[model samples]
Target: MTPAQTTRRHVLVAIALVWALVCGGLGWATRSAIQLDSFEAREDQRRTDEVRMERALARMEAEIAPVLYPERARPYMHFRSYYIATEARYRSDSSDASRDILVASPLKDYRGPDWILLHFQVSETEGWSSPQLSSEARFALPAGGIPAPVRPREAAPENWFAALQERYTAPMLEQVLMETLIHSGEVEGLSAAGPRPDAAPDAESGVRTAAAESARRAERLLQMQREIHPASTCEPELVAMENLEAGSGQVLYNRETGACVQVYAPLMTPVWLDLTQDGEPMLALVRSASVETSKNCTLQGVLIDWPKLARELTEQVRDIFPEVRLKPLLPSEMAASATVRGRLHTIPAKLVAARSPPVETWGLSSGLIGGLAVAWGATLLALVAITYGATKYLTLAERRMQFVAAVTHELRTPLTSFQLYSDLLAEMPQESAEKRRHYAGILRAEAARLARLVENVLSYSRVEETAPNLRLAPTDPSNILEAAAAATAEPCQKAGKELVIENHCPRETRIETDSQFVVQILTNLVENACKYSADASDRRIWLSAAPGPGGSITFEVDDAGFGVAPKDRRAIFEPFRRGTSEQGRRAGGVGLGLSLSRYWAQSLGGVLQLKRSSRNGAHYSCFSLTLPSAPRQC
Candidate 1:
């Protein structure tokens, strides 16, 4: 290899290495940048989730205000008085007259939520009174003749209250109100599941706590109720509710003051004093007057049914946050205000959520990722193509340099022989005919060798530079074969090989081409066949013309010398790339005969191919040249 060619190859190798590094670095950087973008998106999404959660919680706080306070419905629980009449004739004495007399306050028509188990009013004047029961308090007739409120039979046998009394079941709420106003007992058994059984310090305590704590719950109401309730997130010392549902309704007002019933009755139960003291987690609102009126010890409140209230509240906030909870705060929990959101001012409950912080993604998509991968691969492919093309062209340049050197040496040998023969003929005596004739014959052989070499050199140069000058005409395939035979006849005779032509084409078959170009192309092929097959034992060359593939005429030359090696099949068609076979390597004219012939074939708008070789058979190389039958411009 030449120094310049070796240097060019090294440069190409360095360029390939550089391209590989550059492409690899670009791919790595792209991947890292995408991962960073995704991380930033995740942080952005978490911030967004926090803001949305705050707005939803604020709405829940506003909506729940009325239900918790409900101070507007306070008037419905107030008490009033009425009168009763006694008939003299119906009395045991059987008297004649009937008279009206003042009596105790009657029970009002109490219509309120069942969750509000009981309502009571405490005062110094008449002690405790409720609209659910009639009062027996007596007063002297007023100076303004105000009507009296006779006690009603609210605890009549048919009423639920009477059944409780008949069964001797102690009231859950009334006893608590009369004894311990607000204490730990109320908070004892409120569970998200159900009220736990209280250890009976005794039987009386059990009966009182059972009605308040062990009430049944409707859990199959909604799946939301099943999902998030007060119990799941913020469990309290008192209650833990799941799916803390809520409901809303218009308050019913029925103030039948001064109303009466068939009889006056109130529950007078066996007094059992509650011994437990007031504990840390009790909720109450007690108000007193500074200017003190006749009703002094005023304490009015309702003992709420917690299970029913939990359902109402959890349902209310499900839209705002599906996983919300309503949990009662312990005294310690209430004091620590830093961790609390949506804590109720009206009650000891607060709201909590049972979900995690979220991530956001905007710039990262599957399409973006896929596009980057494809682009990276495409760039690498383009680099490989450019590198391969550079290497191929470099190798071609090296082969061209070798061919030039080889041709210079070959031309010198023939020119020196021709000069030597001419000198010998001139120096011989006129009488010695045999010696003179022998020298003359040597001169002719040298002239022919020089001429063929010169012709090939000139023809190759002209063909490479531009299209050949043509004289276009109609010619028969047989006529082209005959002319090629005539041109290569001397070479075959000198090599002791017979040139044979097999013409299968019809007489009428014609080719519209430059006949001169076709003859030169065939002359090159026949000469090349004779030169390479010189060493073969069979000194015969076959030149055949036949109809070829794609409606073109084929002129093939078959030889039985050392055929082209499999490795040289493709390289032999390229300029200066000769076959490596022993016979081919020894006999060659700059490797341009077959190359120039193939060029001529293509310039005539046809194909030239090595259709058969020793690789496909026992031992023959067949070079096939096919020309177009159709007319074409010169």
Candidate 2:
């Protein structure tokens, strides 16, 4: 190819490459922003979940303790809490999995702080659904807070048992199970596969083995109960609790079933005696069991941290029932549930936990992405100027401006298509009733405005250059006047004003001018009148066409608003010399609207002159256009 042709090809290639790079870079940037936003959103959700979980745990401790140990229970511990643990397992043939939990709470009316509860989903399926009971608690009990640690040993004397007649089995069961699970070797795989043979039991076993298993499971169950119900977060410790001494160890097997039910219900159970000394022995009894699985448990109303109670009991059972080498249930291995409520209705615990949902990050994500994108754009521009010699490279700025113009044209083309199709749809006679009522007439107005914008842009481009060809045709001046008046009427009504078309032209008169040009002239004149007359009490737009000396028409549009100054009169028709602020506010434009309209009339062999500007109610602008009469057919 020749040098000029080569140069042209090079410029085109550069432009194409730059455009592609920018587009792809922008797309990638957008995707990165979105993904980062998602990550941040997940983090926020996790934080929110943690917060809610903490609240729920706290609340449960408060409620359960009050019911189980009234003296220990405070006002906050009035409401009961059921402890739960949930574990999920995938079905063999499906991607989706189901979760099981122990000890679900049935108490639904969560009266808590607004910011913490109302908007969140509290359970596995969001609300209360498919909850597991891990361990049941009687009151809020911290790990190792119970009086007598369960261990293989001779039962406390008959007096100890006599004092513990009111003791219940549910809370003890939950604590035993929880402790066993937590100490299990296969705890890590709780969410996935079951425990290995070394860690868990094999199914087939003789009656003796089964009996042993049952006894072990029972002991473990009680351990889980203790784990579930623990002491409150803020209760003051009693010296008597620390002063109580551990008793001598001995194996006390339950002769009835050969199962060693290690009864840790000590008469001198220091944790209980310390409080009972000051007041009555507040019974922290387990009201129910809602355990679904080990890791997943829900104690309907736990007076203690059932899981922790379970753990403690597992140790206690091990110590007391030495001959039974039983394992504490790993959190994954045992499911136990129980409830604890005050004998009297309103004991409260200072610490309370609330269940709530995750937080949303849409606004944060969007703002972050937007800010980054704007920064990246600026940086990219700087890099381009520095590395690409943009200033010296083949009139880059000019080419860029041209590219913008072309791009705008491309954008406007689609908009034009939208306007046309939408307008047509709006005008469809067979449209649905709902659509007709909702969307009719909206598109046409939008299209007109868009068309006007396109005209203004093109007009500005041509301002310093020779204008485009103005094709003339013999047109009826009266028709052009009427169309302009009709167009202005819509705008006038919207502005709470009025428009009047005074057709004084003789029906016999017609002008031979470009019909488009005549329409343009009348539109401009009407617009000026409206702008200057909007605030006037007698706001009106009058259009009149009369036969002039030779076959021309004198068209006028008059308004009764704030008029223009004499010094600004001639300048208003000049390019960019718009009417002052008052006029501009009433009728906004880039100021080329009138100038272009006037130019179009002149180019079409017609005159467009402002008739008059007045301070009185008769403020108006008029234009007289002259053209040859339409040729008559023989």
Listed in order, each prediction's TM-score against the native is 0.57, 0.30
Candidate 2 error regions (>4 Å): 1-444, 463-467, 613-634
Best by TM-score: 1
> Over 4 Å off in model 1, which ranges?
1-9, 40-59, 69-367, 370-378, 415-465, 549-551, 580-584, 613-620
Q: Tell me the tens digit of each residue's lDDT in model 2 across 313-345.
A: 234434223322212222332233112211112
C-alpha-based local distance difference test score of model 2 = 0.44
Quote model 2's TM-score: 0.30
Q: Which stretch of 10 consecutive residues in model 2 shows the poorest summed lDDT? A: 117-126
Q: What is the lDDT of residue 184 in candidate 2?
A: 32
lDDT of 1 by residue, 30-80 (tens): 877687778866766656656656765556556645544553234211332
